[model samples]
Target: MTSMSFADAARICLTAKYATFSGRARRAEYWWFSVVYMIAAVVVAGICLAAGSVLPGILLLLFIVPMLSVSVRRLHDTGRSGWRMLIALIPVAGPILYLVGMTVDSVPATNEYGPSPKAVGQPVG
Candidate 1:
């Protein structure tokens, strides 16, 4: 797997690739960004609880596009269609299946999306 620093991953997902859904994302890149996203969400939730304000919700809305785009790229890394993200719309089993799919390692080399992010010297973004 390709190694990606948390900062680099966050930078790529939150800025450079904020709405980019056409490329592959390495496991490190995806997970690191996810970690940061979740942390911010938790913090926002806490602020919402403490302040009883809708601003937190609005703040989270800003992340939706980046998160969705990163998720699509992550799926592409696994050689799956970005449309597979719709699977999450299903009930219980759907979320479980979706999580499992995202956890799968990137397909060896590359299928169609592009070259493997794991390829030597491949940049995270």
Candidate 2:
């Protein structure tokens, strides 16, 4: 496949791999998805409030798996195990640590998890 731009990567994460949790995700993919997810949440919450209904909550539920999956993949890209995602459970410090981990650049070479997402012509498995 061709290299994806930030928007394309985010769209793929939200649509094609909505619930997939077993691959690496590049930094651009993760950050773009996060920005879009947050914006969407705000918009949905506003719509729900205006309509006085819980309908928009469904949208949030739909994105939950994709969010987690991308996060796991992003951690993998940084050469960390997906299980490290549990660090997000540590109240404030937990999320901060997780954020820092995700912000780190991907390992230049493959790790136990898979190949680098940013590497061209490399098979992911």
Candidate 3:
């Protein structure tokens, strides 16, 4: 899809955010929800391995999409191309660059990744 509605974005997160890599994501949409997903993943992982459990492991497997979505969205917010996320291939610099990139805001108006998501508040094309 070229653009995602608020509801569509949410459903995407729950479904395949972690599976495939495509499209651009807005920062706000990706990061805020990511915080929630991370906490849940950690808790679920712990619970699943807690001696008498396997459910947490299953949940972790299912949780992959959301994790990926947030990361991609974080990249979008930084004003960098989402494909730039591959910078992580480097090793140390990869994650550092990602962290810094995530912290940065969108480049004011727009860059190569289409128009500003903010500008499309009225209706997206």
- Model 1: CA > 4 A from native: none
Q: Per-residue lDDT tens digits of candidate 2, residues 10-42?
A: 677778888888878888788888887898799
10 residues in a row with least lDDT, candidate 1: 116-125
Top candidate by TM-score: 1
Clashes of each: 0, 0, 2
lDDT of 3 by residue, 1-125 (tens): 14545555556577646454444456655665566667777788778778567755776666666666567755654566667777878888888877677767665566665456556462421
Q: Give the winner by TM-score: 1 or 2.
A: 1
Collision count of model 1: 0
Higher-lDDT candidate among 1 and 2? Answer: 1
What is candidate 2's local distance difference test score?
0.82
The segments of candidate 2 whose C-alpha lies over 4 angstroms from its true place after superposition are 1-4, 122-125
Q: Whole-model Cα lDDT per candidate?
A: 0.88, 0.82, 0.61
Runs with alpha carbons beyond 4 Å of true place in candidate 3: 1-12, 15-23, 51-55, 77-79, 120-125
Each candidate structure's TM-score, on Cα atoms with residue i matched to residue i, is 0.93, 0.87, 0.63
Backbone clash pairs in model 3 (N, Cα, C under 3 Å; residues 3+ apart or in different chains), count: 2
Number of residue pairs clashing in candidate 2, backbone atoms closer than 3 angstroms, sequence gap of 3 or more or interchain: 0
Alpha carbon deviation, residue 73, candidate 2 (Å): 0.4
RMSD of each: 1.4, 2.6, 4.9
**Which scores higher on lDDT, 1 or 3?**
1
